[model samples]
Target: MRLSRFVSAASAFLLTAALALTGSGPAHAAGPVYVALGDSYAAGVGSGSYDDSRGGCYRSLRAYPRLWANAHTPSGFSFTACSGADTTDVIKRQLGPLNASTTLVSITAGGNDAGFVGVMTTCLLNSSSACLRRIDRARDYIENRLPARLDALYDAIGSRAPAARVVVVGYPHFYKLGTSCIGLGASKRRAINDAADLLDTVTAKRAADHGFAFGDVRGTFAGHEICAGPAWLHNLTLPVYESYHPTASGQSGGYLPVFTAAV
Candidate 1:
């Protein structure tokens, strides 16, 4: 009877150990399912080393989403963000990756919708007055038209990924003020920075209205703007397609830290 009892106890212990090793134990749980969505910044446009699989989207390994994923090791990760994507593109195309199973979502958008590229181009290639006019136009759009669009996007994100923590990341000022820089004057620099600030404000307010968290990255890129000694953002690139985007350092240093803190 004693021998029989000892054998049964040993068998039960072995079975429990096997279940633990196989990850079938009660303590075992799946990691978070993270989905990254937005535009070029979130896709790491100028960070270099694009994933060919994603094609024109220019999803880079050095991008913040990848960096965040590497550190966190979520059970599943879907990086659906593309280059040059606006809020409309996100609502139509990017939302496909998100679903009921998603637990986390990170997005950096609205700059494109506000015609930021046009503002930069006018400032860089045209007269100061022309730059101001373009800036004013963009700001008008941001104030008059962007709020409703942002509300729609935020609401859609919330509805689609009900359980996910949506983080709306904002853009940084391209130029540092009160500093000498080539190709752009101080006034132009200040105007562009002001526009960025306004964009962040609108984006943050929309996120809050939807009960989503906003990741403010303006302060993180403070000393590392285009005019910095060693700039974090690319002033220009050979392809020109990569211009004004974040460098690899910016992705790893500027964006990663702020995003990490928020998450």
Candidate 2:
């Protein structure tokens, strides 16, 4: 019995010494509980491959949220981002899954609220002046009303998931200026891009105020804007809803990397 006790003590001591030398231990943190929220970009609108089970939300299997969940194999993941979700929709619908247990959250909204889709549509079918006017209206709304809505949404998210590391992702530039694009005139494209910049700036500021990390995908999507050779954003497609949104490659190459880095 004495010999056995002495051998066990020596073995434990050697194990401790080895652990100290190797800088290793047996402690393991639980996996993240990730919940994805926001608008069409978060739902992967242009990425295609939508799940029929999700109904009209157009939640795509290739969206960054799913990509992150697949890569990390998180403890839990709830993808509640809808296609046409605005700040109001999120406050009413999307906050259900978030809780204190959630470790990570991602959302990309404000674009729809700012009416960028309408601005793009106006730029497409109407005169350059008309498009500019529409963009101006959108900018007015974004600057004035959208801020309060965002603050409310961010505050609600915080209330629901206080412990979560919220990553508020912003949109990318839709077009590359100074390029000879056949669709819209150069001036129209420039105005649209400028509006996008304004929207991103506003969203980033609100996110910062909420102590949330803003995953700006603009850098990753720099060279991939429309008319930048092979674009990641769709110009116009058969499914009109997919227009002005990111392609599958955009979700994978553009959004996934930024989101992963943010997380």
Best-fitting candidate, scored by TM-score: 1
Per-model TM against the reference:
0.92, 0.91
Ten-residue stretch with the least lDDT total in model 1: 23-32
Per-residue alpha-carbon lDDT of model 1 for 1-263, expressed as tens digits?
Answer: 99999999999999999998897877757788999999999999999999989779999999999999999899999999999999999999998878899999999989899997898889988999999999999999999999998998888888889999888889988998887788689999899989989999988998888888898888889899998867889886677978999999999888999888888
Clashes of each: 0, 0
lDDT of 2 by residue, 192-235 (tens): 88888898899999999999999989999999999996899999
Give the Cα lDDT of each candidate. 0.90, 0.92
Give the worst 10-residue stretch by lDDT in candidate 2.
21-30
lDDT of 1 at 64: 98
